[model samples]
Every structure is written in C-alpha cells, then in structure tokens.
Target chain A: MKKYKCIVVKSQTYAKKAEKVLSHNGISSSVLHCKAGSVSGCGRCVKVEEKDVDRSVDILKKEGVILTGEIYGL
Target chain B: MDYKKTVYLDNAASSFPKPRSVIERMNRVLNENTANPGRSGHRLSLSASQIVFDARTVVADFFGISGHEENVVFTYNATYAINTVLRGLLRRGDHVIISDIEHNSVLRPLVAMKKDGISFDIAETFESDDLTVSSFSSHIRNNTKMIFVSHASNVSGAILPLKALGDLCKKNGILFCVDASQTAGHLPINIREMNISALCAPGHKSLMGPQGTGVIVISPELNTEISPLVYGGTGTDSLLDIQPYVLPEYLESGTLNTVGIAGLAEGIRFCMNEKNAISSKISSLFSYAYSELEKIPHIRLFSPKTDNVGIISFSVDGIDSEQITRFLDSEGICVRGGFHCSALFHKKALSDRFGLVRVSPGVFNTKKDIFTFIISIKRLKK
Candidate 1:
C-alpha cells in the first residue's frame, strides 16, 4: 500500500475542528505542528495520507477552512 | 450631512476618523522635515531624530515604562515586532507556554520555531467566566523559558489576567511577553508593573495612528543582548560590520515609517488625553449591544460579560458568518467575519465551521449605530 502525505495548513485554534472533520470522514490524519510561512503566522497545518488527500481537502473546504497551501507525497 | 451617516464598527482592526492632530503632525513632518533619522548630523536629520525620540517618549510614558526612549524599537507592525522577539529570543530546546486565545501572530511564530527544536504548550482557557491567572499556572513547566499571551483577544475581546500572569512569571523567573495589539491604546497597560519583558502593539488599531507603524518595547534587563533579527546600517556605528550593540538602534536597522510615527505620536497624545472618555464610550456601547444581543436567543456571544474591550464576537444559529456579515454590510454596517486569525481558538470553542462575526465599535460609533446593528441582526433571525 502506497501512503501519500497531504499537508493541511490551518489555524492552530482550528486544529481540533480539522481533526474532527478528518475523523468524521474516516480519513486518518495527523496534525502537522508547523506554521504557514506564506501568511505570516495564520494557522496550523495537518498531514494525512496521499490517498485521502482529495477527500480531506474537500471535507475541510466544505467546512469553510481557509487552506493556505498543501503538499503531497510522504 | 455626510457626518450624519456611515457607522464605523471595525475599530479593533483599525480606527476610523483619526484625530485631526494626527494628520496635521504627520503632514508637518513630511512637508518640513523628512530626513533619515539619526543618520546625519545635519539640521533636518536632527529634527527627524527629535520627532522619533519624542514619539518613543510618548510610547514609553503611555505604557508606564520609565523614560528610556532607546528601549522602544519601531517596526512595520505588531506582527513584525512579535516575530522579532520569538525568533531572536527562543532557541532550540526552549519551552514556551502560550494561552488558548492567542492571535495567529503569536501562534504562528512559535509554531514555526517548533521545527527548530522549540517546544510549546498551551494553557486551556476556562470554559466559563473568569479567565483567572491561576488557570495558567497549571500549564507552566519547569523548563518553560517564556510565558507569552495576548493582553486582550482580537477575536472575542476577552481581557487576559496580565497582572497576575506577570507576577507568576516573575516569581518563576520566566520571561513574560505580552501581545497588546487589541488593547494598547484603548485599555490601560503598565509594562513595568506587569513585569512584561517585551510588549508588542500595532499603532494603527486603537492608537488612531496610520498603518505601517508599530512598536516593540523591550525591558532594560533584556536590552543588553537581544539580537537584531535584521542587520544593516543603523545610522550609527557606520564603520562596524556587526549590528550595533545598543538598545533600539540594534533592532531598528532599516528606514522607519517616520510619517506614520509622527501620526502615532499625535494619536497617542490624543488617546492619553481622552482615555477615560473613550473607554467609557466604548464600554457603554458594548454593554448596550451585549445586552441586546443576549436577548436574541439564537445568537451565541463569545466575549465575556465583564472585562471585555470594545470588540464582540457572536454567531447566529444556522446562519453562515459570511452571510450574516454580508447582510449587515448591506445595511451599511461593517463587521469582520471568518476565523479572525485565531483558528485554534475557533476549534477549541467549536466555532470552526462558520467562525464568528466580530463587531468592534470605535469611539466614533454612536447609540444609533448599535441600535441599527441590532435591528439588522434581529431581522436575520426571522
């Protein structure tokens, strides 16, 4: 099984919300404790498997999360 | 009359209808004396230096710091000031403790620094009323090198227990840094008494100053060796290859926003003279609006009843924050929507989906504005 890494950049205050969104969608993801460099300290990002990247992004966007950027491939 | 309309409720982001004195002073500086401050011994340069020095003095006095103009370093904005401290002070292996309601400006820098081996822990805010200082003590670790938190939240307008936190950090021998972006000019702050080692604030917000001007006040104790994040000609020690080992000149390397600083000086002067009146007016407005909003059963207010500034955050049941903001905008009302740069707080508060509509009233707002806003919100409920 190939594992794809998807970075979920968001506000740290929204970390639990993002986690919940991922879990509800059954997409296993881990919160990546890094700052979104481009936005001058906007929020936190999460990392998930590449296979679940599309679903995860859709879920987050559906939930109105502001995604700064994302990177794939673990 | 044009003055008879247009409600400006976004003061927490930046003030509107800036004092005429602020504009006049800025104009004076630009027209008569616009020179590189502290760069030359010429008369124009000396005059520019005097303007900066006077502004620094006003900032120092306003914040309750003793006369030490050199300790006040100017920056582009509060975010820049916070980044300077977080990057310069914290090193690998350092442990920092922050609060749950911090703005992204504080959170992001620390998050980035975590990659370099710095670890962070957050103190959970009390679920109910009263965010007391004792709540923060439990989160402090033996390895905690710094205790950083905001003086007041930009999102919810909840004032943190800075005095108590300052005492705890002082007793624990930890560096205490405060982000005063939301409360610097509107609320009273005493850096000396609070034991705040470094204080960061945006001059444009409550200070009624123009954008592009911010300040970082460093404690004299830490002034000896705080590294400069950016290094260049500081208009002093021109021959030295290294950054100046002084107070402000060390951190202030590039050309400053002189015009903005001049405006900020006047703004601070106006704030100082009208602090009590301005606070009372803002509080009255918030109190009236909070009471009215509480009556709207579907709306959940995030700011505490007491100890809140002029800002208020609330969510309308089943209505998207953007939609509500747009509706209010259509009524000629201004409000901020979305996560308000505090995504972590939104997650913790369970408001991540729609975020919250933040309405911050300034001194220029009136009773009619609040009444109209309430009517607009109530109409949305129906």
Candidate 2:
C-alpha cells in the first residue's frame, strides 16, 4: 500500500517528461500503475508524496503536460 | 580490443575502442531491455525509455542548453542530425548561408534541396574575425533564413569564429546552426553563450561513444516547427494519427537506438568528468604533432600550428595521398587518406587531384604515436 498522491498522464512520454521536471526540482517520484478511473493511453502514472502534490502539478503544467486526475491514498 | 598499442589517428572517421564503461552500459541495455521506449508502459519498456531520456538530458546539460532537454533529438549520426535541421526547418524560396569549408553532410543536403526552390550562398573565411563576419553578413537577405557552419573544419581542424557569427546571426534575426561534429566533445561549446539556434554532433568522434549515436541541440526560440523527419510512433498523442508537435518526440520517431544511446550517456559522462584537463592534454599532443610534422619536407600542412582541435590535414607535395595512406597502413598507423570527406576543402587546399592525408588525433593518442607517424612521413618522402 502506497500513501502518495498520483499524477495521471495520457502516455508514458508525458509521465516521463513530468518525472524529469520533478526530479530536477528535487522531488522524488515513482512510476507506478495508473489509478482507477483514469483515462490514459499508457499504463503507468507517477506517484509523488502527498506533501509535494501541488508543486508536482505546477511543474507538470509548466512543462505542458495535461494531468487527467489526481488520485489520493494509493 | 588493445588500441593502446596501435597508433589510431583516424578518430574523425569513427573512434576506435570506446570506453569500457560505454561498452558495458550498451551491453547491459541490450540484455536488460530491448522493448520500444516511450511506446509501452511495461517495466522493461519504461526502463528503456528512461535511458533515452537520460541521454537527452545529459547532452542538453553538457552543451549548456537550458531547461529544454526535450529539444535534444537523437539520430543515427551527425549527418542525419544536420539533414534534419536543414530539411525540417528550411522552406520553399528560403535562402541559406553556409561557410566555405563545410562537410558534405551539410553541403549535400542543401544541394539536394535546391530542387525544392531553396538556394544557398557560401561565406569565405579570411582568418580574420571581422572579415569572416562581414563575409557572412554581406550574404544576408530578407529571405535568408539560416546560417550553417561547422564549428571546426573536419578537413583542416581550423576553428571558425562561432561566437562572432552567433552574434551576427542574433543581430540579423536569423537562426544560427552549427555543425559541431569536429568540436563537440573536443571544445567547450555553450549553446546559450554562443546564441546557437541548433548544434549537431556525432557521438562517436570525440564524445567517446559508439557509432550510430548522434544528437541535435535545438533552441526553443526558433520559429520553425521542424516537421518530423521520420514519423511513426511518438508514444504520446496515441489516438491522433498526426505526429506529435512536441520537442523531441516530434522529431524522434520510430524505434530509437536504445543500446547506442545507453552507451552515449556514459560517454558524455566521461567527457564531462574529464573536460578541461583532457582538452589541455589533447591540445598539447596536437601541438607536438604539428611541430614535428612541420619539420618534414615537401609537405603542405592545412591546419594551424596551434589553436586546433585534434584533427590535422596535410599532403606531401607531388605525392598521391592514397600511396601515403597505404604505406601508413602497413606501418600500423591508422589514418585516413583521400578527400577526408570534404571535397570543398580539398579543392581549397589545392589537393583535390592528389587528395590529403588527414590525421585526427584522439585523446588516447600519445606523443610516441605522433612521433612514429612523423617518422613514417619522413620515410615516405625519401
């Protein structure tokens, strides 16, 4: 059981690019299975710690990646 | 495998005996993940995708391309990278300017595109910074879209005034593209400082990577959308039939050279770690070789005595270059002969008929290796 929030992306490309931006910002994340009720072309999503959720979303948005949903308490 | 004993001076062609870590990394990638990167979400596929992204990020940081690691597009060689920029960005009726001494990689593509209603002009270098700048500036027109020049001539190892030209391009509002195949890992090139719009380089030469790895560091400011050179699966925008309009994914289509890029990342790491000291040592060795070769008679040296990258091109007066190359081959000294793949430069060097023997020393080459090469040249003069 993971206690982090999720950033659902349409594909692995956006997910990876988001991960790159987040990693450069000193936020650690893991590529885990996408959350339930997520619409994605790819199977994976990035899981970031709950405290860093807002910053992660901001970074992803800055990089032009669209976040479909944010699932909590995974 | 033991290139330490062989006098390998043909680094400009393709580097021999890549770093052990490069080979090991490639082997690991080939064994661990052969899946298509960014296309699938499986663990192995994601791992392969990460290596590709890592190579891009490493290249961007190494070249001082700010914040847009996604703009670093990987290709099979510098030739492909150069062609991508030339063809992708140029439009009909556009005029492109190129330096007089450019590799066939840049020249051939422009020549081929002439059929598409594009034209080009050549800017001659006079060994003076102001004169060279004027040469390029004089050719700029309203339709002039870009300026493409090699950072250093592969045929002569003469460095171009890149920063001055970059400034000129900036003032003129034209995209400045540099073919860095000869100087990428050899010289310190900060794309931001140079105001370069695009920098294309091969991973095999001074970058210490294996063949089949090349990169293009593009500026985010260029108006050119850079239509995809090869379009297939970008892994993003999967439902859309059209190609993605992003930075790397747009240009990078089809399956990437995952194993080669894996090795290339380590190669860039090695270069980064060994930057200033390694460049100094290479320059010292080149100076030694240049001086020693100058002592030989009936030789026409085309490169500068100092201030040159590891490459040096020269010809023995009245002696065919092929004969010298064959003799050197027998001497176990690996150097390239005949044209060195730059006919324009060979013509300017006045050795088109006779060709030129190009000696591109690698960082791994030693003073003893250069001494042996000079002695061999001396023997051939007899």
Best by TM-score: 2
Model 1 residue B100 lDDT score: 89
CA lDDT of each candidate? 0.80, 0.83
Q: Please give the range of 10 consecutive residues that has the lowest summed lDDT in model 2 chain B.
A: B235-244
lDDT of 1: 0.80
Candidate 2 off by > 4 Å? A1-13, A23-28, A32-45, A48-53, A63-74, B1-5
Please give, for residues B205-295, the per-residue lDDT of candidate 2 as tens digits: 8898989999999876666788767888876655567775666878888888999998888998889988986788788878888888888
Question: lDDT, candidate 2, residue B165?
Answer: 95
Compared with the true structure, what per-residue lDDT tens digits does model 1 show for residues B164-265? 889999999899999999998888888888899999999999988999999998886664356778988676435456664555767888887889999998
- Quote each prediction's TM-score: 0.81, 0.93
